[model samples]
Target: MFIKIIKRTMTIILIIIGLLVISYLLFTNFYPNFGGDIANEQKEVYQKSKQYKDGKFHNTKPVPKDLSFPETLKLAYTFFTTNVPNGRPKEDLKTKKVDSINIANYQGEARMFWFGHSSFLLQMDSKTILLDPMLGKVAAPHPLLGANRFNKEFPLAIEKLPAIDAVIFSHDHYDHLDYGTILKIKDKTKHFYVPLGLGTHLKKWGVHPDKITELDWWQNTVLDGLNLICTPAQHFSGRKFNTSQSTLWCSWVIKSKTENIYFSGDSGYATHFKEIGEQYGPFDLALMECGQYNQMWSDIHMMPEETAQAGLDVKAKKIMPIHWAGFKLALHAWTDPINRVQAKAQELNITLITPKLGEEIIVKDTTNNYPKWWEKY
Candidate 1:
């Protein structure tokens, strides 16, 4: 009886091991490669497009050596092995509900609050623009793949979001744009601004064609005294299989009559910042990308110091590092990026604002004064 029991136990253990091996192989092979070929092709076409033709891809800034795949994977594995710390969810914060911004009050002023990660609500003049809103809990299509979103939830649910004059999508990356959020907020949006091919995903997700305005790099669009200029970024994009660079990735310069705001959608160290600054700089504010960076993907995401430098490159008066404290896209400690950014910004003497998820930082006409809001967290 003992021998028989041992045989059965061995059989079950073997089965489990076999299943584990199969699952890893499946994810490593099929899952990662699912849309890979299409993405590769899209990249080829994107490279040949006018944006590339105009020398946008030619200029670049020096990046660190660590942003390679091997290093990125190693760091990611190490990050997963270590436990991540927690912070107060934005929902728990006693934030001021932006029910109705007296456009009259802050007239000629600008205000921006990062909901989390790439989700930023900007109020410039009387227009409210939401940038790459990924307010959902999971940054993945399904909840299992991505880490849980850090904030309690966006201060307001997507359906409950106030009227958005424009929804600017940086790319199709899950962390940048949320499908469900768009579905809910679509009706309230008058225009959906995105890069060349990103509109395809928005359309697939139910946003109307007429509502979508696709722009290549250096393209400019005007709406209600706001000039939206799409500039290039060193990055890639895709939502599913076969569509990698079919769309463009970019930063944006939001210039109203008096205020200049730049959103570094997602980028590596690039010379475009200086060019962008020359074209539309001396900006009052720059919502630069500063999180989810690993040495492996350094070509795409900016490191903490790189982010601050980019702010200076663009000649921004104030820098509010966005892209951190929301999702664990990289293995680093949750607060490490912001901590590093603060240090770097201080060294550079660049003004940095660390607002809570829902806390609004109003750029007043007189000057930009931000309290140390992230101190408690």
Candidate 2:
């Protein structure tokens, strides 16, 4: 009887394991096209890149990509079990709805609209540009794996957006390169600018090949009246477990005849910031990353203090802290990034702009002030 009982337990265990394997396969492979196919031509182009080697891309500076299996397990365990008090707000955060008509009619003035987190609408030189527009409810492959966005509604839906002159991507991470959001807005966008190997993802998602332009680090392109240069960032990328570092990540430099702007995609404190400043210093404005960071992954994401310093390193006349106030991708309090960066910016005498989500920030206007909207929550 004991032998029979052991046999039954083993059978059930095997059945459960089989079911789990099947579920994972369906989740990753069958749900939808995760991204564009890496075609032979694309692979040949990647092989020519200095950063590509051994079937993957590498950062210019040495950076660790993965933690040990045990450490990853511990992270997952803590993430689910910990009581992250300020990880999310009790009530929905406040936001403004941008007037689409005003945006369409504007001419020659450089302006920006923050749509929470890293996504922004940058109108410069009479052209409308979008940066990492993950305007979706969730920032994961599926809603099951990630929390919904902090705000219940986006300031402007894709249907309501004016014809975008260009859409720029920093990397292939879901938060920065969402699949659903791309599908919805591809028809309305005229062109897409992405780091090396990321155009494949866009191509897979139905963006016309002619409309996509891929650039390596330090490569510049002239679109309309703006000069865009792809710059370096210390980060890794992959949508699935097996494809890590297959795509390059980068920051961006947007220079117009009147203004120079820097967008730090996502990066740790590195000497590249200084190099970029020397090459294109005295930026009129800098959008720096300042959230979702922890000591465990310090080599990839910058701390708040580092964010302030990076702004200075790039010789930015004014700085705005991004990558926070939208999602809880870390263990720290939701308000911690902004609070700490604000203090550090004050100490460093960096001119910081903390705009509320959806608030308009005129690039040339220095006197406009934004309320500390997160304090009430």
lDDT of 2 by residue, 65-102 (tens): 56776888899898778888778877887789888898
Compared with the true structure, all predictions reach lDDT values of 0.74, 0.89
Model 2 accuracy (lDDT, Cα): 0.89
| TM-score of every model versus the real structure | 0.78, 0.95
Q: Judged by lDDT, which candidate is best? A: 2
Candidate 1 stretches with Cα past 4 Å from truth are 1-48, 51-79, 82-96, 100-108, 364-371
Worst 10 residues of 1 by lDDT: 55-64
Distance from true position, residue 330, model 2, in Å?
Answer: 0.3
Once fitted onto the true fold, the runs of candidate 2 whose alpha carbons sit more than 4 angstroms away are 1-15
Could you tell me the TM-score of candidate 2?
A: 0.95
**Candidate 2 clashes between residue pairs 3 or more apart in a chain or in different chains:** 36-204
Residue 64 of model 1 has an lDDT of 28
Clashing pairs in 1: 35-241, 38-242, 39-244, 66-295, 67-295, 67-296, 68-296, 89-152, 90-152
